[model samples]
Target: MAPLASDPLGLAIDTTFDDTSVAILRGKREVLANLTLSQFKDHEEFGGVVPERASRKHLEAIQPLLAQALTRAGVGFGELDYVAVSTVPGLLGSILVGLTVAKSLAYLLARPLIGINHIEAHPYANVLAHGELPFPALHLVAAGGHTLLIHQTGHFQWSIVGRSVDDAAGECVDKVAKMFGHAMPGGPAVDRLALTHAPAAHRFPRPMLNDPGLDFSFSGLKTAVLYYRRDHGGDLEEGPVLSAFFDAVIEVLIVKTLRAARRFRPKAVTVSGGLAASQKLRAAFEAAAAEAGLRLLYPPPELCTDNAAMVACLAAHRYAAGRFDDLTLDGRPNLLD
Candidate 1:
C-alpha cells in the first residue's frame, strides 16, 4: 500500500506513562501543537515515575494538550482525518486517558480510531520523519518498561525477536544513576558522567552477549555497577567511582546493540525509546552502523523519549492500513503480543 502523502492530515493523541503529548501530522511531518509534561521533569527528583502521580498528571494535561493541538492544526475535532492513540504496553491508567479521550473524539466525529503499541510507535516515528522504513529492520526498544529487539517486516507487522530477561536498559540506567546520586531518567545522567570515565577501566559482563539467542539480560550488569560503586565508592581519578560504573553500562549497551545488528543483518537498525536519547548510545550506534555498513536511524532527542509524535506517527501508519480498534480494547500495563 502507498504511504500517506503531504496532503492529508493525521491527528494523534499519545498517553504513555505520565506525559501526554498531542499532535497533528501532515503526512510524515508534524503540523500542529505538541505538549509535554513539566510534571515529569519534577517527578525525576524522586528517581522514577509514580503510577498514581503520573496518572494524575495525565488527567490534568491531556485536555489542554488536545485543545492546543486542535487549535494549532486549525481544525475542529470533526475535521481530523484519523484519530490515533497508543493502546498497548504502557501504564494502564495512563493509557486509559488517551484511549478514552481518543474514543470519545472518534465516536463523536465519526472517524476511525487506531490503536498503536507504545513500543512499535518508537520505531515508526523514524519512518514518519524519514519517509520510509527499510524492511526487515531491527528496532532495539530500550526504554523504562521494555527492552525489546523487534523485527519489522512491514508496516504494522512486527514480532519480538528477542527481549530482556530482567531490568530494562533504561531501568538499569536509572537504578545505576540513583546509586551515584544523579537525577531521574538516569540514562542521560549516566551518559553525561560516562564521558569522563574510561570505557575499559573496568570490565563488566556483557550478560548473554555470547549466547546464540538474540535475547538480552541487563540485570547482571545493573548489579555489577551497584557492586562496583559499593566496593570502590564510585571513585575514579577525578570523580566518583560511579563515573566508571556509567562507562561500563554504556559499553555493554553498545556492544549488545552492535552484536544484534551484525547477527540480524537487517536493512536498518533503530535505537529508540528513552535510552535512545543517550548521547553515548547514539554515538556508539552511529559508529557501529558505519563500521558494519548498516543503516541507523533515530528520532530527534525530544522525540526519543515518550511523546505523542511517535504515537501519532504509528497511529497514522496503522490507520492508513485500515487498522482500527474498538472500545473493547483495554490498556495493557504489561501487554505483550
Candidate 2:
C-alpha cells in the first residue's frame, strides 16, 4: 500500500553489527520490503564481530542496501515521512554507521528522526507477527549481544525482569561454535547441528536455574564446553556437543521465563531476537505453553533476527506519539545506561 499523509511511511535502518539492513514500512504493521546484507563472510575468520570491520562493512553496504530496499518496496525518499534507526546497545562504530545515514536523511528530508532501542524493538516483532499483544506480557529477548526478560505494560512501558550477568545466550552459542571451528554467526550453524543428534553423554550445566531472582548466567556453561573439548579431542563429534550446549541454554531460558510468568501472571509469553529462531526451543516453549494453558507468541524466523522491519514497526508507534529525536542523536554502546 502506498503511504499517504494519514498513513505515513517510514524508513528503518539496522546496522547493529554484521548486518547492513534496510526496510520500508507503511504505517504501524505493514512492511513493504526488508533487505539485509550480512557481513558474516567478512568477519568469519575473526570468530566474532570486529567493531572496526563491522563499521567499515556497514558503510560499504548501507547505501546500496537502502537503494535496493526502496526499489523493492516501490517507494522513494520523497514518500518517507520519517527515518527510524537503531541507535544503541551495540558496537559503537556499527551503530554510528546507521545513525549517520538516518541523521542525514532526516536533515535533508525535514522528517522526524526516531532513535529506537534495538532490544525494545525486538519485543515488538511479536506485535508485528501476531497483530497486537495483550497488555502486561512477558517477553524473552535472546539475541547475539543481550539476553533479557522484560515485563511490558503498554507500548512504551517496560521493565527488565531478568538479564544475563555474563555472556549472552547467543554470544555463548557463537563462542561455543567458534570453538568447534564454525563461522562467526554460528547460532544457525549450532542450531542445525543440535537438531540432528542426541545430546552428548556429558550433560551440560544449567546456570542460574535455581536462583530466586530471574537473573541468568551462561559463561560457566560455555566454559564447561571449553573444558570438555580440551579433555576430549578437538575432532570430537559436534552434533551431540552442540546438542548438549543448546539444551542447557534452552532449559535455563524456559524455566526462568516460566518462573517470571508465574510471578507476573502475564497475558502471554513472547520470544524475540535471533536465538528465538531455534526450532527446538520453540517446540519446548510450545509444549510448556500448552501444558500450562498459557498463550505463546513469537515472530516468525524472518522477524526473529535483527531486521529493520521491526525497527520501522516500533518507530511507527513513536511517530504517532510524537517521540522524535533531533539531529544531535548519537549511538549508545550500552543500553544499560
Candidate 3:
C-alpha cells in the first residue's frame, strides 16, 4: 500500500432526515462535525415518524451542517482530493438535498465525485473506526427503512444474504411503540423500558426461525404482538406483559442476527445502522458472537446510527482503489447495486 501514500482526502455528506452528519477523512482518520434535527423529540407527540416532517428538517440542516464539517476538518475546498455523496436508496427529497449540494461542490472544485450507496456505507462506518473489515463478514443493518444481512467479501463488495419479507426491525419497533403511545423512534424508549422488564415474562413468536435461508419476517411478529395486545384488551393493565413484549422484540432481533452469523460463518460480525444503538441488541449480538466463536465489531453508539463518517471511510477505500464515479452518476432510488 506504499504507492497509496497520497491518501485521497475524503468528504461525505449525509442528508438522512433523522440526522444530518458530514465528515472529512484523511487516510483513515475521521475529522467530523454533525448536526441533528431535534424536532422529532417535540413531534413524538404523534408517536411515529412523519416522512414529510423529516424531509423538510433535512433540507434546513444540510447547508449549514456541510460548512461545519469543512471548517472542522480545516481543509480548504481546493485541498479536497475527493468529494463523496450518498445519492440513492433513501428518501427522495432528503436524498436530493445532499446530492445537489455535493454534485455542485464536486463540479466547482473539480474533484473526483464518488456517489456512495447508503446501505453499503453502514458496514464501513465500522471500518472508519476499525481499520479493515474481515472477509466473509456478516452485517445486520437495522435501520428504520432497512433490515438486511450483507455478506462482506471484501472492501466495498457485498452480497445481500438475507432481507426482511415485510417490515424492517426498526420500523416494526416504531409501529409497535406507537401502539403503546411510545414516541418517535420507539427503539430507544422501548430499550429503556426493557432494561427493567424481563423478556421471558411473555412469549412472542420468533418469525422465520423455522424457515430456510437467512431471511427474516417481522410483519407477522408485529401483527402477533398486536393481536396479543388486542386479545388481552383491558386485562387490568401492565407490569409483566409490557416487559414480555419488549423482550420478544429484542429476542427476534438477536435470534435473526445470530442466524445470519451462523449461516455466513464470517471472520467477524458487525451490527450497524440506527438500531445498532440499542443496548439489548448490542448485548445480544456480543453474547451470540461469543457463543458462536466469532468476532463482533460495532461502531460507537453515536456512529452506529446514520452518519457521514461511514460514507467517508467507504470513499477513502474506493479512492485508494482508483474507483471513481462520473458526474453522470444519478441518485438511485433503490440503489442497492
**Candidate numbers, best lDDT first, in rank order:** 2, 3, 1
Give me candidate 2's TM-score against the actual structure. 0.90
Candidate 3 TM-score versus the reference: 0.88
The lDDT of model 1 is 0.72
Alpha-carbon TM-score of each model against the true structure: 0.87, 0.90, 0.88
- Candidate 2, which segments miss by more than 4 Å at Cα? 1-4, 39-55, 234-236
- lDDT to native, each model: 0.72, 0.87, 0.75
Clashing pairs in model 1, backbone N/Cα/C closer than 3 A: 234-240, 234-241, 234-242, 235-241
Q: Write the per-residue lDDT of candidate 1 for residues 1-337, one digit (tens) a residue.
A: 2344335567777776756778787665554655565533554432343324454467766666676567767888766777888777777787898889888888887777788878788886676557678888988888767888888888878888888888787888788777667778667767776666655456676788678777778889878866765676534332334455555555666666677777767898887888888876688778877987888898777777777777777776666667777756677777565
Deviating ranges (above 4 Å) for candidate 1: 1-6, 39-55, 234-243
Question: How would you encode candidate 3's per-residue C-alpha lDDT over 255-321 as one tens digit per residue?
Answer: 7777777777789888898888888767877887788788989888877777788888888888888
In candidate 1 the C-alpha lDDT for residue 312 amounts to: 75
